[model samples]
Target: MKATHQPPTHAPVTTADLLRMAALYLRQHGWTQGTYYATTTPTNYPTPPACAAGAIGIACAGHTVEHFTQLDPDTLADYLATLAAFVDHLDTAYPMFLIDDDGFALDEHTSPYSWNDDPARTAEQVITALEAAADESDQLHLTGGQN
Candidate 1:
């Protein structure tokens, strides 16, 4: 007798729902590759100059499953809006002058910094890039490995 493996079934869902499911799946499966953490402070860099004293901000990160899934347009828009709002709030509330993958606040840029000028716009741009990547991933999945 031969064993049969079944592929996971994922129904059409919202981006938020998919994100939640991915998070849950990663946690349940103990998949460390998809998991990540960001620090509000400059932990990756050296102290003092690189990291200002008492500079604090929010650390946000998430993981996506290996499976490719289409994102509901409305949900994706909502998620992007929420992210923009959060970034705007953080920019207004904190003295965050620097931002990186590690969420570190390193040396402050000189005047006329692009990100400092408009954090919300920057956040939106970031979300847009991510959305494009997601779309590509979905396409690749649909095509069965062709990127």
Candidate 2:
């Protein structure tokens, strides 16, 4: 009798799944990122990257590190608004990034791919990506201000 070999099972995450995971991670970090985001249509002007790829990041603007300690509600709100726009801009840009740059594809036979070298990007990393996207958007320039 001949011996049979069984292939290993592999599961790759989808773009939608990654987006959902990113939203959950952001919420866990206390930035208040919403579960759903709207996409800008036509033009497709700005393309952003997926959360898994660190393309659409999070950020807090007009709020300094000291503000958090002071507990300024107004400033916090402003920061949140900026962060939302930043994320939205990212949503707009992500598709573009996927189109312009080589797409991220995982082979079922190969090992799974990691978003960041750390495998899991920290909150700081998310903020950094958001800032980078904002810069690319050219809508707002993020200066190293804290939230």
Candidate 1: C-alpha RMSD to true structure equals 15.7
- The TM-scores of all predictions, comma-separated, are 0.24, 0.26
Off by over 4 Å in 2: 1-70, 93-128, 140-147
How many angstroms is residue 117 displaced in model 2 relative to the true structure, after the best TM-score fit?
13
Candidate 1 has an lDDT of 0.32
Give the residue spans of candidate 1 off by over 4 A. Answer: 1-70, 99-147
What lDDT does the true structure give each of the candidates? 0.32, 0.36
> What's model 2's lDDT at 104?
59
* lDDT tens per residue, model 1, 87-123: 4433544434755779886654322123333435342
